[model samples]
Target: MMIKNTAIIDIGSNSIKTFVIDQEEKYSKIVGFDKSMSNGFDGNKINNFDTFVDSIKNSINKAQKQSSSKVKNIILITPTSKNKNHLISEVIELNGAQIEDNHLRQLNKSMIIKYKTKLTHCFKSHYVIDNKIITDSPIGINCGSLSLNAIATIISDEEIKLFKNIFSKIGLNLIFIYDSSIIYYLYLKSLNLHKKNIVFIDIGSSTTKILTIKDEKISLLKTLPIGSMNITNDLMTLNISKDFAEKIKTKNIDLILNDHSSVEIPVWEELGKNQKQTKSYEFIQSIVTARVDEIFKLVLSSIPKSKFFYSYLVTGGGSMQLNLIPYVKSKFGIELELVEPKQVKGIPTFWNNPSIMLPFCLNSLIENGYIDKFNLFKKNDSFSNKIWYKRFVDLL
Candidate 1:
């Protein structure tokens, strides 16, 4: 059945974002968009369950209101960790000149077989292959072997349950669970400008999601523990309030200071000290720049340059760093582009604005029926199909 209006909720380490959309056979209409600070789930940690659940409900309600329609299906995308071993193995084999269509299929089957314990809904596999990466089904090429590097992520069942339970409590029908990275990648694809080798670094508040897309498919997916919170932690170590530290971090303004230049550093009351003087930008920038540099270098290493692919895209909250883009370009000497979600069609003009663009695009895809296209995998019948499996195994 063609569901009318669809809604998508993306729960990230930094925010809870929602999108509502409707599409006919010919056209798609984005009706609503909303997001709220719900960094309840940060990386593998859940700080406050109550606050997270409440924030989710509020975001969904706002989306429903803006759309002026009941949410037919809600696709929840969470950053629960995924296993990347299978994809890595596939890349290794391909690089070893042992890859074929059958090999790819075997890898896919093995992924499901291994992670069936965690998977809960229909899904799709997107391969981001560097030039070194080889496939048996090469469109039109004759080469000895392909040395490819890949990153694959498997969404977890428990993560889906968290969103489903939240929706159930809020009186909404849960649709399919999605990979937030996948959703965001599709948003980039819709732009049609990023059809080359590109990596998207979504540096959120507490966690950074590194994704590489090549040949219009996901090549690598990784979630790192480092994020903007590290800068806050650095400030907190100086005994400063989290709020004040956040302000300074965001401003990113460096004031020229002589030897007389000094900034107040908070000292703990237990230590019986009010404030200590220190140079403002020198110390903080050293910590922040070092962390940010490590992240960029790590992302660069993940992209195999031998593959002849060279396009990097930066986004998310940490990208708000004023000098980050230029600094990355100057430091890495690789061409990097900032992704603009407002460039896509059917996206409302308001959402085209800063910061909200990525989530807004993701929310619209879910609210519309586009998310339904992702439910391509059929339910498994392992019990009844045991004989077929056995026969297949015998052939192998």
Candidate 2:
């Protein structure tokens, strides 16, 4: 059963984006792309359902036209608010048979049933076969019994229903939904970069998602109520429109660009009036750095000892604040790596913008056989399909 072309919609606080891709054998043909302002989404919730649907429709239609394909299935991705981390362990007997992929699949299925009321997503931490610990999947090894630890996110039923209703209004099925942070982490892990210990961060428009990979297995997932939008709002202290504020925030707030506090930038009270004032780069830096620093402090509170991780990788619009790397080094003494999606054959150069890169990665991961066919977790018969989310990844 080969699904030829599919659409990926990324709904974020600031915008709605879509990519209509033609999944090919060796490469994904990216035939369509769009990023549109989100209406109906008032940062925290969908306040106007009708307007929200319109917004999503606009984004989807623009991309679909470019692809010349009517996309029916959507792998929806969002930076959802309700995600929280939980640790679960499950054990099973193999009866001295060789541990195969199905063995772990069954083990995970059992674990989900026990916690079906809670799990939105689950990722393996590691496995112990016959009382011996292993990070690699014990697929071919003969084992009497196997046990595993996993990190899973708990999503609210309310959120899932909201997704359903939104898609229903748009006249499309909500084939699958994924939390952006979790999917972003999954895409990275699939690269097999050999990063043993890492604290991955994504600063989205209204939320910051953090996930930890310790000892080559995922350990935790977290979401915080902070993002680049805060920085833009903070710049409104000068009484500029949100549009103008966002422009300068993106243009000036950078490591190489914003470093000279001694330099001053011109500020306009009303550009048409030609009235102007001067503010030191230091002023803007203070406002921007303060919020970014707070974001990291909050991350530390959630996952203490993040400083000990071998790598601190970050993405999303906030990562464009190049100064953050040196700033975190000075404040917390942690090195931060700005992760960009690697160039797969079909990805256009502009598609790598951190804010909208998740869809591209999702398309690539699907083609590369990195993502499991796990249907959000096949907990019941209603999700009828040969479900994928296997090993969630074969890393463990």
Candidate 3:
């Protein structure tokens, strides 16, 4: 059987991860994986661009060494640090002529120009044609005028420049750039979950993203600055290294109360001295629980009360916490489901880690033809066609 190779680069707030996958007709195998910490930037801008670029270069090189194929095209996924959403409406007069794809494209282009923001993704809610509402495309239908309602997610231009420069430096072409939340939404929708009014919570090291899907469409996307890292930082007050604190956070710890139970935590002192500290399990749990509670509270407050979601799904590294599911349920009065890459068939067991879920989803989408390959590199020509062409050529 013949195989094709593709690569995915996921730059999150806490880390930069790269994956190389080989896909046949029916299955995909992860051939390479490389990850590097972001030096505490966690998706935010840092003063040292060269250091950040070097980190990305090292990660890509490691993954390349593990793969057999040369990685030419890359799908880049980045978290939305200061993401903004707008419900934009655009109308175009048809003058009793049939609507065409170009007409709809023009309308979309106009909206993009009007917003004047770097758009990450846009989903059309519905189209109004001659007073008739349609969820699908209204192409080839005679209408006096057509109006479209869409939700657009926007990110900072500076962030895009940073990633583009990093990729250019590494001699890789960016075929697709997506907001991490959008990628997660696409992955969940692919699972055939078929749940209406679903809420997705993705917890990362330094941030958490919340997205709501209504009628199988993304209704909201939000990111909060607080994430699992906050809990780890809280544990650092015990004089433990961040690395050790992270290990404790993910070590099947329980949030339930056991007042009399205690666990001994070991730490390294100066001069290579070994020190053992005894602390009540309750104390550690209390520190973690407090931060988690704040995270959930902020999530709840950000979501509008009028919106009703029947199902809630949590994913990402932070969601791997042993008691996160039950704790979220008890605190928010909503049952939460943990999403795992294992749920998707044909993915190797070793590649089931949540940290690589974004790249895995991108691979699946590309292999299944859900997302067009060539179209991934195209830019919107709404404002100026010439400018779009120039930009496209420049990327080449």
Candidate with the greatest lDDT versus the true structure: 2
Better of 2 and 3 by TM-score: 2
| Candidate 3 weakest lDDT stretch, 10 residues | 374-383
Model 1 misplaced stretches (Cα beyond 4 Å): 1-6, 22-27, 65-67, 70-72, 83-154, 188-195, 214-217, 238-243, 254-279, 304-309, 343-358, 361-375, 378-396
Candidate 3 regions with alpha-carbon error over 4 angstroms: 1-6, 22-29, 89-156, 190-192, 257-260, 306-309, 343-351, 373-389, 392-396
Best by TM-score: 2
lDDT, candidate 3, 61-139, per-residue tens: 7877887888766667765556566666789988999888998778767776775334556655557787665455698
Report the alpha-carbon TM-score of model 2 versus the true structure. 0.83
How high is each candidate's TM-score?
0.66, 0.83, 0.79
CA displacement after TM-score superposition, residue 174 of candidate 1 (Å): 1.4
lDDT of 1 by residue, 52-88 (tens): 7788878878877877677766655654655332243
Query: Whole-model lDDT for model 2 versus the true structure?
Result: 0.71
C-alpha-based local distance difference test score of model 1: 0.59
Winner of 1 and 2 under TM-score: 2
Q: Local distance difference test, per candidate?
A: 0.59, 0.71, 0.70
